[model samples]
Target: MNLRKVGSKTNVLMMLFCILFLTSACGSTVSNNATAETAVATSSSEEKTETVKKTEPVKVVWWHSMSGGLGEAVDKLVADFNSSQENVQVEAVFQGTYDESLNKLKAAMDSDSSPALMQVYEIGSRFMIDTDAVTPVQTFIDQEKYDISSLEANILGYYTFDNQLYSMPFNTSNPILYYNKDAFKAAGLDPENPPKTYEELAVAAKALTSEGQTGASFAIYGWFIEQLLANQGVEFINNGNGRTTPATSSLLNSEASVATLTWWKQMLDDKSMMNLGRKTDDTKKAFAAGQIAMTLDSTASLRGIVSSADGKFEVGTGFLPKPEGSSDGGVVVGGASLWIMNNKSQEEQQGAWEFIKFLAEPATQAYWHVNTGYFPITQKAYDEQIVKDNLTAYPQFQTAIDQLHQTKLNLATQGAVMGVFPEARQLTETAIEEVLNDSKSPQEALDDAAKAISSKIEEYNLTVK
Candidate 1:
C-alpha cells in the first residue's frame, strides 16, 4: 500500500512539471508575437510618415503684373491649376504694371518676401539675366528632355540668350493696326484692306477722319515706337539687338527711328491723328467711343476693344504698318514671360516650373487666348476646340496669329534687350513728345534720346559687370 501511494505522487509531480513547462513556452511565444507586432506597427508608422513627407505640396508665390480684366483671367488660371493637382498650390499676387512689378521685384531681391516666380515684361529680360537671379528655363528643359518644339519660335527668341531659353513666354502679343471697320466703310475705303505701310496708313487715317471722328489716335507710347522700328528690320540696340552680345549702346536714333517719328509727327501736324497723350487706355476709350477710327495697340487689347465696340462698330485688325517699300521686317513679340526666381528653394522652384508647364499646355493656352487677347505662345493651342470656337466667333483675332507667323525670324524681329530698357523706353517716349509738340524736330529729339540712352547703356553695363 505504501509503494502505490509513492508512485501516484511521482506521476502527479511529473504532470505538474509538464504543465509548467507548457505554460512558460506559450507565454514566451505570446511575448515574441507581441514584440513582432510592435515592430511591424513601428515600421508601418514610418512608411506613412515617409509617404506624407514625399507627397507634401510645394507652395509657390507668383508675382504678376496683370490687372483689371486681365488680372481676373490670371486668377482663374491659377485657380484651375490649383484644383487640377495636389503637387503645387500657386498664389498669384497682382503686383501692378510691368514697371511697378519689376520695381517691387528689385526691392525684394535679398529678402524672403521675394516671389518664387515672377511675370516680367519682355524688355526686362536683360536686367533679369544681369541680376543673376534667375534659373534659366533651359535648365529644366535639358534635365527632363522636355519637348518645347510646340512653342512659338519667335516668341521664344525674345526670351532666349546665348542659345538658352531664360524664361517661359506666358502672354505674348504684337502691336497691330486696330481700326473701326464701320468707319472705314463709311469713309469710302475698303474695310478688308487696312493700311500695311506708313504711307498707306497716313492716307487711310486722313480718309477715316470725318466731322466728329479723327482718322487715328496713336498713344505716345514708346512700345509702339520700338515696334515700328523693329517692323522696318531696324535694330533698337547694337550687338545684334543685344542678342549677339551685351548691348553697349542704344540704336534708338537709327534712320528708321527718325523717319518713323517724322512720319508720326507729320500725321499729327496734318490733323489726321490725335495726340491722345501717352496712355493707351485713353486711346482705347476714344476708339471704342467712335471718336477715333484707327489705333496702334497690342493684340492683347483685341478682346477688350472688340467688347467695348460691341454694339457701336465692328473692329478690324491688320499687321503693324512698316515704312513704304519695306519688305523684310516683322513685329517683335510683346507681352510678358514667366521667370523662375533663383532665390527660391529647389522644391518651390520645381513647383514654379510645373505651374509654367501647365500654363504653356495647349488647353491652358487656349483658355488664356479666348479669355484674353494674348497669343497662346503654342501652335498646338490653335488646335484646341476652344481656340477654334473663339476664332470663329471673333475672326479679327486671326490677324494677330497670321502676323506672328508671317514675321521673318531675324534678330530685329526678335526684339532688343538691355538692362536699361525701361528707362530707354521713357526716353524714347519723351522724344516722341518732343516731336509731337513742336519742341524738337524728329531728328533732334531722337538724337538727344539716343545719346541719353547710350549713356544709360554704358552705365548699366559697368554696374552689371
Candidate 2:
C-alpha cells in the first residue's frame, strides 16, 4: 500500500492521542491493584486487633455449695489459685447448699452466664450427664495424657461412665459415728473400742441413755439410710447400683433395708435413739451440746463437730456400724465433685481444668484434708506434712481414712446413682418418719417408698431418653 508523508504537527497530534490512551489504561489498572492491596492491609489489621482483644487472662466463674467453715476453706483455695497463676483467674461463688446450687444450675442452663466450673453433689452425677452441659474431664485428661493414677480409684469409679471421667473429685467423705468418749466411759463401755456392729451400737445406745442425755439421735435423713444399706453391702437400686445402666427402679424394700429400719424403730421404741426431724444440723447440735452421746454425720463435719464439742466433751470418731454377719460392704463416698461446663469458651474450660488439677495436687489436697474433714482425692496427699500433722493432732480423722482404705471396692461400696436421687431421698425420709411414728411398719413403709421412687425413676428415664 502507498503511504502519505505526514506533517510534524499531525505526527505530534497522533503521538499525543496514543500517550493519552496508554495513560488512562495504566491509571485504571494501578487504581484497581491499589484498592485490592488496601483491602488486604485492612483485613490483616483487623485480625491482629481481634487477637490482641483475646490476650487477657481467661476469667472463670465457679459455683460451689460449701458454707461456714467449709466455705472459708473454699475461699482460701480460690485465693491461692488466683495468686499462683496469671493466665487464669477464678472467682468462686457459694450459690447455696448442694440442692440449691443444682437448681440454680438448671435455671441458668440456657443463659450465657452459666458457670464455667460447678460443684455438684454426688447424686447429681446422672442429671449432669443427661444435661449434655459438661465437657468431660476425660477430654482434658486425654489431650494432656495426664496421670490420673494418683487419684483415688474408688472416687474415680463413681464419676466414670462409658469409660469417660465426667468430673474431678473435690471433697470426698463418708458417714461416720461421732460419739462422746466421756459418755462411753461413764456408761462402762470401752472408750477405745467403738461399736463395730448394729447390735453393739444398740447396746451402747441403751447404756448411754440415762438421766439428761439420750444414747443416740440419728437425723431422719435418707442419706444415712442409703449409707447404712450400702454398709451392709446392698444395692440401693438395680443395674449394679445404677453404674452399668440407668436404674429403672429402687431396691429399697429388701431384707437389708427392712432389718435396718426395724432396728431404728426398735431403738426409738426402747427410747434410746431420738428422732430430731430430717435436718442433720439438729442432731449435730445435740451431739455437741452433750445432750446426745452419738450421732451419724459426714466425716466432712468432723472439724465443725470437734470445735463445737470443745471444752465440753471428748469427740470420738468411729467407723459406721453395720448389721451382724454382713461381712462385705463399705461406706460410699458422699461428697461433691467439680465439673467443667461445656457451654463456655475453650479457653475458660482449659482454665477450669487447671483449677481442678490444682485442687487434686498433693499440697492443696493435704491442706483441704487437714482443714476440712474431707478425704484427699489423691493418695499422694498423704505424703504432705500437713496431713501427717493432722493425723497426729486430731487422731479422730484417721478413722475416716482408715475406713476408706479398709473398704472393699464393690458395686455396693461404689454407691448409687440416680437422676431423681434428691427426690428419692425425700421419699425415704418420709418412710423413716412413718416407721418411727408407728404409722406404717418398716416393710410397708419401705415398700411404699420403693414403689414411689421406681415410678419417679421411670419418669426420669423417659424424659432423658
Candidate 3:
C-alpha cells in the first residue's frame, strides 16, 4: 500500500480507538473498594507501615468540540498536564460539534453539572456573555497576576465584551486562500501568484474553473460575509463596542454589503464559482479530493486538508483578496475560545484557570499551532526561536499573520454581538442559496434576510436585556 494511504488508515484506526475508549469510559462507574482496603489493612501493623497516599485529586472538567487529529492533540495536552501536575486532574470531554457543544453547555448550566470550562465559538460568543454563564478570564488572570502583555491585541478584541475580557482565546483561526498549484498551472495562471483583488480573482476564477474543478469556495458563509463587509468598509451592526453591545442591530442590507452579496451572486451565475453546499466538513473534503482548485477557509483547516490529501496536492496559501478600488480589510477571527463556566468551587475555578494559563504558555501555544494548524494568539508564541524555525519549514503558516497586518479594530469587522447570530447566519446562508439558485437578486435576497434576522435579533435582545 502507499505510505500516505497507510498513514491515513492508521489515523482512522487511532481515532476509532479513542472514540471507543471515551464511549466505554463515560458509561462506566467505578466504586471505591473500602472492603478490599479493610482486608489489606488487616495485615500486621509492621507490614501496613508502608504508608498509603490518601489525598483525592482535584478534578477539572473541560468540555470541548475538537475532533480527529485535533482531538487527539488536545488529549495529548491533557495527558501531559495530568502527568506533570500532582494536585489537579483534568478531564477533557469531546462534546460533539460546535453547535452541539454549545447546546450541551447550556443544558449543563441549567442542570448544575456544567464543566469548569467550555469551548465557545465567535457567533455564540455574545450569547455566552449575555447570560453571565461565563466567568471573566481577564479577571482571573488579573487576580492571579499572570503576565499577559505577550498576548496580541488583535486576538484580545475577539473575546473582549464591554471592554472587559471574558474568555481565553484558544484555537483562534482566520480565513486564508488555499489553492492547488497544479490546477493553477493547468489553467495557465502563475502557480505562485494569487489574486490580490476580488475582480482579479473573479477573472482568474473564470479561467480556472472547468468541468471537474472550481475556482474558489469558502468554509464559513458568515466568515466570508465578515471579510467582504470589511473589505468594502461596511459594518454589520452599530455599536462602538464589539460583540458585547446589545443595542447594536443588523447591517446586512447596506450598500457595501449588497455589493458583496452581488459579487457572490454573479460568480454563481457565471458558473465560475461553485457552491459545493455549505458546512466546513463537506467543503474541506471536496477540496482535498481535488474537486475544487481554490478555497477560502479557516487557517485551522490546513491540518485537515494536509492530512486528507496526504501531501498529494501542492497547496498554495495566500491572504484573502481585497476588492477592486477598495482598501483591504480585516477578517474576524473564526475559532472557539475557552470560557470559564460559573458555579464551580474556588479551588476548582483556580485549577481550571491554571489549565487555561497552561494553554497560553508560549511553548504550549507553539505545540498546538504546529500540531493543529491554528494561528498563535500571542506574539510570544510566534516569537519563540523554535516556533520561528518551524515556520521557516512551513511558510504557508504565516499567511494569516500576514493578513493580520492589514487588520484594524473596526466594529463592523471586529465582530457582531447580536443575541441570535447563529440564527442570523442560517438566515444569511439561506439568502446565499437563493442567490446561487437565481431565485432572486442578491439585494432582494439579503433585504429579506435582514428583515427576518432583525426581527429575531430584537426578540432575543429583549429577553437578554
Candidate 4:
C-alpha cells in the first residue's frame, strides 16, 4: 500500500511538469497559426477592395437645359456613353430652361461647385468667357490633335473667338419658315414655293388670312429679330458682334432692326399675323391647331410641328425670310454649345473632353439631328446613312440642312457675343411688346431698348474688368 501510494505521487508530479511545458509550446504554436491566417485574410480582403476601387467609374456631371423629347435624346446619348466604356460615367442634370440654367450656373460658380460640363446657349458665350471659369475647347482639341475639319463653319463661328473655339457646338438650330400645305392650297398659293422674303410672306399672309385663321404667327422673342438683322448683314452689336473685342454697346436701334420691328408691327396691325406675346408655345399651338397658316420658328421645332400636324395637314419648311430688297447675308446659328468647367480635376477635364469628342462624332451628330430635329454640326453627319434616310423620309428637314449650308461665315451671321446679351434680348422682346401695344413707335421703342442695353453693357463691362 505504501509503495503504491509513493508511485502515484511521483506519477502525478511527472504529469504536472509535462503539462506545464507542453501548454506553453502548444499555446505559442496556436497563436502563430491564428496570426498567419488573419494576415492572409486581410491581404485577400485588401486585394478585393483594390479590385473594386479600380473597377469603379469616374462620374462626370453634365448640366443641360434640354427637356421633353430633346431631353430624352440627351439621356439616350448619356446612357450610350456610359455603356460604351467602363472608365467614365456621365450624369446629366436638367437645369431648367437656358436662362434659368445660366442663372443657376452663375450661383454655382460662386460656390465653386459648377458642373464638369454645361450646355450654354450661344448668347452666353461672352458671359461664359468673362467668368474665366471655362476651359476653352480649343485647349483640348489642340492638346489631343483632334481634327475638327468636319464641323460646320457657321456653327463653329458662333462659338469661336480670338481664333480659338471656346465651346463645342452641340444642338445647333436656325429659325425657319413653317407653313401648312393645306392652308397654302386653300389660299391659292404654291406650297412648293414658300415665302423667301418678308414682302412675299406678307403677300401670302394677306391671302392666307380669313375667317378665324391668321396667316402667320410668331413669338415676340428677340431671336427672330436677331435673325432678321443677320440676314440683312446688320451687326447686332459693335466690335464685330463682340468677336474682336468686348462689346460696349448694342446696335438695336439700327435702321435694319427698326425696319424689322416696323414690318412686324404692321403685320400685327393688319390682323394677318398673330402676336403670341412672348409665349413661343402659343404660336406653336396656334399653328398646330390650324389657327395659323405659317409660323417662324427654330428648325428644332420641326419634330414637334410635324408630329402635331401628322393627320391635320402636310408641313413645309423653308429658310427664314429676309426683308425685302436685302441681299443674301446669312442667318446666325441658334443653339447651345458644350463648355468644360475649369475648376474640375485633370481627370474630370479629360473625361469631359472624351464626352465632347464622342458627341462630335458624325454618327452621334446624325443620331441627334435625326431624333431631335437639331441641325447636324458636322458635314459628315449629313453623309451618314441614317441622316440620309431621315432626309428622304422627311424632306422638310432638308430645307434646314440646305439653309445651314448656305449660311455665310461672317460676323453678322456669327451673331452677337455680348456679356449682357440675354438682357439685351429681353429688352428687344419688351420693345416689340410695346410696339405691338401701340404705346410706342418702333423707332422709339427700339431707341429706348438700345439705350438701356448700352447702359447695362457699360455696367457689366466695368464690373468684369
Candidate 5:
C-alpha cells in the first residue's frame, strides 16, 4: 500500500521485479510440459518399433506339384496361414507334375539350391529318404510335442518307415473306378452296383461297348498296374516291398502280375477297353465326354471329372475291381507328401513345420478335401461341416472313403518302398505297352521288365549301401 507513495524510480524497480518473476515462472512451466511431451513421444516410438519387430514374418518357399483345382486350394491354404499369424509367410510354387517336380528337386539338390519344403510323390519317397536331403517330420513333432493322434492311420501308414514319419501326408488319394451312370443304364447294366471283380468288369465292358463308344478306357500309367498288383496281394519288390530291407530284385513277373497283364491284354484284344496311352487326362476326357463308359483313375480326379462332365452325365464311383477269386488284398494310397529340406536355416525349417502343421489341422484339411477330391489326411476333417456338406452333395466321394476304410494295411498295400521305384515303374509301364501293342506276350514282356528292374534294384541297393 505504501508503494504508491514511494519515488517514481522505486516504483519502476518494483514493476520490473514483478514482470521478471512472472516470466521465470511461465518459462519453468513450459519447460516441464515440453519434457513430459518428449517422454510420451519417445515411449510411443519405442512401442511402435517393438510392434514392427514382433510382426516381422519368416518367409518360406514351398515347392509343390499340385495343379488345377488342387493348386488353387493350396494357394488358398497358404493365404489363410499367412493371414492367421504374423510369424510366417509361405510361398507356394508349382513345380510341374509329380515326376517332373521330383526331377527338378534332384537338380536343385545337385546345385545346393533346394526349396525349404517340397512335395514328393509316393513313388519318390524312398529316393527322397535315401538322399538324406530332408528332415523327418517326426523330428519336428518330437521337438514340439505335437499330438498327431488326429491323423488318418491308413494315410499315415503310407509315409511311416521304421516307426517314424518321414513326411507330412497331404492330398492323399486312392485309385477307384469312375463310370458313366447313363452309359451303364443304356447298356442294360445295373447303374447302382458297379463291377467289383476284373471278370465282372470285362462283362460290363462288353455290354457297354458300341460303335462309337468304348466300354472302358485307362491311361497306360504304372499307378493302376501297381494298384492291381497290390489288390492281388503281390509285392512289387523283394524284402517285403522294400519295407523290411533294401530291395535287390523285383517281382514284376510274378504269377499274379502276369495274370493281371494277360487280362488287360485280352480286354484290349477284344476291343472292350480303349488304351489312352500314358496321358491321364486323355482317358479322363474320354470318360467325361461319354466316349467311354468307365475309367480307372485316382479319387483325386473326381473333382476334375465332375467339373468336366458338368451335368452332361451323372458320374458313378466304385472300388477298383479286384482280380477274380483274390482275397486279403487292398488298394495302396497315392498322391504326394510334404518334406522339409534339411539344409535350410533353423528358422526356415521351423517355419516350414509351422506351415505344415497348419495344413494338417482339421479345418484346413476339410477345406482341402472338399475343394479338391483328395481324401483328408486327418480323420477329424471328416467331421467338419464343409466335408459333411461335400459328402452329401457328391456321394461318389463316399466310395473312396469306404474303399480306404476297407483297405487292409499290409506290405503289399503299403506299396513298394524301393529306391529304384521310379525306374521299376517305368519298366512296368514299358511291359504293359509291349503287351498291349502285340510286341510281346504278357509273360515275355513282364519277364523282361522284371529282369531289367532286378538289375536296376541291385545297382541302386549297392550304391545306397
Candidate 6:
C-alpha cells in the first residue's frame, strides 16, 4: 500500500511494469486460442474432402454370356448407362454361352471375386438362389427405391423364387413354330392356316413334307421336350418344381411323356420330320434354307429368319399348338436374367441397381423386343403407341405377343425349377438321339433318360438339403 506514495518516476516505472505484465498474459492467451481454431479448421476441411471422395462414382462389373451382335448390344447398354450416370459406371464383360457363364460365375463366387451383376439361365435360377450368394432383385429394387410395377407379369413371375424376385428378366424368348409360306402352299395346304392343335400339327407336318422338303424339325433339347410335355399336361416330376425339388421318382415316365415321345418317334419313323440330332443351329439352317417346311425353335429366330431369308422365302409364324381339347398352358420362358453378386461394395450395389432399373424401363424393353425379337416384359411397353405403330411393319412378332395372351398359370408350364436342369436336358437330348437313330425304341429311350434324370434329382436334392 505504501507503494502509491512513491516518487513520480518510481510510480511511472511501476505502472510500466504492470502494463507490460498484463499485455504479455493477454497476448499468450490469444496465441493459444488462434492455434486451436486453426487446427479445427484444418480437421474439418480434411473431413469434407474425404466425404466427397467416398461419394464419387462407383464401378459395377457385369459378367454376361450374350455373344455375336447381341453381345455388342449388351456392351452398348453399359456404355449408354455409364454415359447417362455420373455416380455409376457399368462394365459389361462377356463370359460365353449359358453353361460357360454359369461356370465362370461359380468360379468367381468361390474366389470372392464375383462381379456386381451376372446373366444367368432360367434353369439355373433355383441353384443360384439356393446358394444365398445373390440378393433378390425385388429386394434390391425395394431397398434401392425402384419401381417394379412397370415390369410385365410373365417376366416378373419368371424370376420370382419363394415370392421374392431373384433376378431381372432380360433377353426373354419362347418356343414357336416357323414355317415356309411357299412350302405350305406347294403342299396344297392353306398358307394362312397353321396347325392350332398337336393332332392337326401332326397331320399337317406329314402333308408339308416331301422328298425335296422335310417337315417340322425341332431341336432335341429339353426346352422343346419340356414344352411338348407341358402342353400335354404332363408333370416332369412328382412336385411341380422340375429339377429344384427332391422327388425320388421320375414322373416323366408317365403315360403322357410316353405318348409325346412316341409321337416324335412316329414322325421320325414315317420320315415326315427330320431329327437333325441334338444341334439347334442345324435345324435352323435347314428351315432357313427352305429344305424344311416347318421348324419349332425360339421366337428369337424371327429376326434371323427375316434377315437371312433375303427375299428367298416367305416366313410365317404361329403359336405353339396345344394337345387337342387341352387348355393352352404357359410356355416356359427361355433366356437369361440378371443376378446381383455379393462381393460388390454398397456404393457399387446402388450403381448396379440404377443400371438394372434403366434396363427394366418400358421404353428400353420395347426397344429391345423390337430390335432383338424378344418379347417386351411390361404391359406398358406392349400398350405403348410406338408398339402399336409398328404392328403393321412387324407382323411376325405379333404372333409371340398373341401367344402370351394364351398362357395359363399352370406351374408345370409356368416353368420347371430344378438344380441340374441343364444336365437333365442333355440327358433327354441323348435319349432323343438314340430314338431317332433307331438305337432304341422311344419308350426305351425315354425310360433310360428318366432313370438318369431320377438319379440326378436325388443328387441335387441332397445338396438342396
Best TM-score among the predictions, by candidate number: 5
lDDT of 1 at 99: 93
lDDT of 6 at 173: 87
TM per prediction: 0.89, 0.87, 0.83, 0.88, 0.90, 0.85
Residue 223 displacement (Å), model 6:
0.9
Clashing pairs in 6: 243-418, 243-419, 244-417, 244-418
lDDT of 1 at 8: 80
CA shift at 220, candidate 5, in angstroms? Answer: 1.0
Candidate 5 stretches greater than 4 Å from native: 1-48, 51-56, 110-112
Instruction: Tell me how far the alpha carbon of residue 409 in candidate 5 is from the true structure, in angstroms, after superposition.
Output: 0.6
| lDDT by residue for model 2 (1-465), tens | 011333587865664565477677765754665677778889999999999777888899999999988899999999999999888999999999999999999999979878999999999999999999999999999999999988888778778888899999898998999999999999999998989989999999999999999999999999999999888889999999998888999999999999999998999999998989888999999998889998999998888899898998999989999998996888899889999999999999999999998898999999998888889999999999988988887889889988888788888888899999999999999999999998999999999999999999999999998
* Model 6 residue 400 CA deviation in Å: 0.6
Task: List the candidate numbers ranked by TM-score, top first.
Answer: 5, 1, 4, 2, 6, 3
Better of 1 and 5 by lDDT: 1
Q: What digit string (tens of lDDT, one per residue) describes model 3 on residues 30-117?
A: 1123344455566655364544334667899999999988899999999988898777899999989999999987777866678988
Better model by TM-score: candidate 2 vs candidate 6:
2
Clashes of 2: 0
Task: State in Å the error of residue 359, model 3.
Answer: 0.7
User: Poorest 10 consecutive residues of model 6 by lDDT?
Assistant: 240-249
Preferred candidate (lDDT higher): 1 or 6: 1
lDDT for residue 247 in candidate 6, whole number 0-100: 53
lDDT of 4 by residue, 1-465 (tens): 122323577775654555567677765655565687778889999999999888767779999999988899999999999999988899999999999999999899956568999999998988899899999999998997999998888889989898999999998889989999999999999989999988999999999999989999889999989999999888999998877888888899999988898888888899998887898889999999999999989888888888899999999998888887887678888889999999998889889999998898899998999999898888998889999898888889888888888988888898888888889999999999999999999999999999999999999999998
lDDT of 2: 0.91
Instruction: Report, for every candidate in turn, its global Cα lDDT versus the true structure.
Output: 0.90, 0.91, 0.77, 0.89, 0.88, 0.78
Clashes of 1: 0
